[model samples]
Target: MMQNHEEHDHHENGSELSEMQLRVRALETVLAEKGYIDPAAIDVIIEAYETKVGPHNGARVVAKAWSDPVFKQALLANASEAIVALGLMNRVGDHLIAVENTPRQHNMIVCTLCSCYPWEVLGLPPVWYKSAPYRSRAVNDPRGVLADFGVALPADTAIRVWDSTAETRFMVLPMRPAGTEGWSEERLATLVTRDSMVGTGLPKNPKDA
Candidate 1:
């Protein structure tokens, strides 16, 4: 009787959310009812992702690499170690590889099998990133995928897609825009967007940002 009541309540409350969100809500409801988890703790975790450990961490890392040649070298050679040097290590991100977006080539990150993301750096994966369409199209139609994101690369530029896995994740080091020579790391960090870091979009133009 209680289970039926819970299921009814779940359906009543879940009409507006996506299927995945509904399922997660239902699971959370069950766990909370059984005393296995606290809903307040879940709220805290979501708050931390929203306000505390977010894209700013990744932006700092990107800015540091942009300003420091040695750090850039280290990042390209061993991303996991480089990020750890900046103290951004976390449980979900055991191994991370950094890819550079150069003039001739671009890089994009995706997890085709699942939504395996670098949460330590990126905080939380965006909703579209976990959607089925993106997962299927990121590898199969990267150019179109990028176009949909409003990133129009030159026809000559080659696109490289990296698949994220449970053991290894990837981050993109976007090319620094021109006309920003001698800029402070703080200023550069502000120009780094989460989408740019994800390789779905480009960094904001200095003038526009």
Candidate 2:
């Protein structure tokens, strides 16, 4: 009986090994035939995920805020609650914080320890955003960091840098772009890029890319 039990255990272990081997073989075949994965492929995959399953919902929220004064006030007052009101607080470990950007005060966000982003609202952070240079330097020298991103603020313009924690996430509510006077919400959402929502880039105008 003991020998039979040992044989059963060996069979189970062998089955598991075979399953793993099959998976590895399949992966190897795909890799060799399809060629090694491209680094740029990661960006394309992430962009696809963002379009299919991420912060596009929040883009609608921002567009609504831009068009409606009351919603904008609610969003500015309590971003997490406002987002919940829009039925978009579904992701785990996501805590939303809104930072408003204005002519006088521009807001930028960074996480020094890790990439703690408001993925529900802004999708994945850009590559530069997760870099150590950006995280370490943004808090200490916000103006310079913005300058590096090609955003040169006026000397008098106050820059507010919000450091996100693992438990809390943040997004930038960019000032509504000019000349978008009568655009629909969907049209406005087109201008809201992930970079603009992260404060590293401004919303693209109708003419601008």
Candidate 3:
């Protein structure tokens, strides 16, 4: 009975969101399939939303992980369980693995076959994420791909690519920005962006936010 009640509540709370996601996904898919959009234009739109607008739930998750060490440990250990346990997601379809950005390594996500995204946290995948060139280049030429996104990592930082399959998706836990010490989770979430969680960009510096 409790499980059924939870399902009922989840559907009531999230049905509209799910529907809109479907509509948006359908529209973007149709446009991309018809060759009506340019990949560069798509990148610009994503940039405009950086820090200013984004998947709030994902940002919140990122902030919580940043502020809480125990939670971060669990999140890095098992993203699907951690997110669901936090009440941020009712379920995680398939497996959701999380990779963290560190001084020695930067993690990026790609779905070479298709756009297998963690819609529960990050919302719909961006157009650039689904493009053919991005899928091919993210693995073969990661540095060049980051350059196109205007991201310049340190020469010593190794870029690690996590490929998403139909049954497994991934998210990036970006390094917390400096000058954010003692900041509230709410304040820190403002620094998280969709691209940062995807690994194409970094969280907003505290000053920038």
Q: What TM-score goes with each of the models?
A: 0.75, 0.71, 0.74
lDDT measured at residue 88 in model 2 versus the true structure, 0 to 100: 58
What's the TM for model 2?
A: 0.71
Clashes of 2: 0
**Best candidate, lDDT:** 3
Candidate 1: which stretches are off by over 4 Å? 1-56, 88-92, 112-115
Query: Of the pair 1 and 3, which is ahead by lDDT?
Result: 3
List where candidate 2 sits over 4 angstroms from the true fold: 1-55, 88-94, 113-115
Candidate 2 local lDDT, 1-209, one digit each (tens): 00111211111222222477579667766876687865467567865665454545667878889999998999888888887887756542356778888888877777643336676566666667778999777766777777787887777778777766655667899889889999899899888877778787788877773
Q: Where is the poorest 10-residue window by lDDT in model 3?
A: 1-10
TM-score of 1: 0.75
Q: What tens digits encode model 1's per-residue C-alpha lDDT throughout 1-209?
A: 00111211111222234489679989999999999999989867875665355434888889899999999999999887887877755433667889999988888888642335776787677767877899778877889999999888988888887776556788999999997899999999999988998999988899997
CA lDDT of 93 in candidate 1?
60
**Worst 10-residue lDDT window, candidate 2:** 1-10
lDDT (Cα atoms) of all candidates against the true structure: 0.78, 0.71, 0.79
Clashing pairs in 1: none
TM-score of candidate 3 versus the correct structure, residues matched by position? 0.74
**What does candidate 2 score in Cα RMSD to the true structure?**
14.6
